[model samples]
Target: MERTLSSELNTQQVSSKSAMPLRLLANLLQWQRRMASRHQLARLDSRLLADAGISEAQRFSELNKPFWR
Candidate 1:
């Protein structure tokens, strides 16, 4: 029983370690997407901004946010 428990714990630890890279990749992708969206948001003209119901202040707020956020 002890051996079985130890083996299971080891497997779980290995699985979690393997998942870390995938998690970091996912986070990097998300940050990239956030950066792209913020860039597009910054390019919007006043008319488009109004149409989208986004104020200049709101756009500034979003644009100023860190990609990690």
Candidate 2:
């Protein structure tokens, strides 16, 4: 009975530890998606800037600013 309890506790600890990596993987995936979106937006912004006669350097400078502003 004692051994069984010990094994159960060990299993629980291992599962909890494994969950951390899964959470980290989820976070990494989320970050990757956000980065992809930002890249697409930057590409679109560059095109728009070109249409507006803005230089590439100026577009990059403006891109450094927050999107909401």
Candidate 3:
């Protein structure tokens, strides 16, 4: 048995359509991680920031960013 050109195209189209929601979910999860990391940064004390080699100014800049950014 052999596949026809139309069947191949249909298979590709179905695969592409199904991937869209997965990509969206991955993007949303990435955004959530960024937001949580920023919140954690905001909670860090000066000593912990120093230990991590992050300056207060740098921490402020990252923590101040909008989650969407």
Candidate 4:
């Protein structure tokens, strides 16, 4: 009975540890999708940029900036 309990505890601990990486991967995927969307928006013409109140200079800056920033 004690061995069974210990095994179950170990299983739970392993699952808990794995959960973190899974969550991180999910977050990474979400950020990737958002970055793609941002790039698509940035590709728009100057008229759209003006309508969005985002200047060409700002768009250029954002395009050059790192994704993490």
Candidate 5:
């Protein structure tokens, strides 16, 4: 019974360890997507920005932000 418990704990630890890299990858992907969207937002014309209900000030704010934010 004690050996079984130890093996289970070890398995849990291994799984959690493996999850760290996946989490980092997910975060990086999200940041990359944010960067791309910001780039597109920067290219928007006044008409398109008005259609999207975004003001020039809002677009400027978003464009100036860091990708990680």
Candidate 6:
């Protein structure tokens, strides 16, 4: 079997390595969205929270989570 530049570049290890930075960025964006939603949750009025079925304790727990989580 012979290897070509294109084939080598498409290998699992190389492709995974190439995607690492993009995946990290995507993960960070998702984390930021989660954190932002949590911040929004902290600002929700009692009526809205009740409508969303989120209790005060639940909202507090989510809002307290670290962005890395």
lDDT of each: 0.96, 0.72, 0.92, 0.83, 0.95, 0.90
Q: Give a tens-digit lDDT track for model 4, residues 1-69.
A: 356888999999999999999999988987787689678877899888888898888888778766655
Selected candidate, larger lDDT, 5 vs 6: 5
Error of 3 at 27 (Å): 0.7
- Between 4 and 6, whose TM-score is larger? 6
How well is each residue in 12-49 modelled by candidate 5, as lDDT tens digits?
99999999999999999999999999999988999999
Per-residue lDDT of model 1, residues 27-58, tens digit only: 99999999999999999999999999999999
Ranking by TM-score: 1, 3, 5, 6, 4, 2
How close is every model to the real structure, measured as TM-score? Answer: 0.94, 0.49, 0.87, 0.59, 0.86, 0.78
> How well does candidate 3 match the true structure, expressed as C-alpha RMSD?
1.3
TM-score of 3: 0.87
Could you tell me which residue pairs clash in candidate 5?
none
Tens-digit lDDT track for model 2 on 14-57? 99999999998888887677666556646776667677787877
Candidate 2 regions exceeding 4 Å error are: 1-7, 45-69
**Candidate number with greatest TM-score:** 1
Q: What is the TM-score (0 to 1) of candidate 6?
A: 0.78
Summed backbone clashes in each candidate are 0, 0, 0, 0, 0, 0
Candidate 5 regions with alpha-carbon error over 4 angstroms = 1-3
* lDDT tens digits by residue: candidate 3, 1-69: 799999999999999999999999998998999999998888899999999999989988898888778
Model 1 earns a TM-score of: 0.94
Clashing pairs in 4: none
Model 3 misplaced stretches (Cα beyond 4 Å)? none
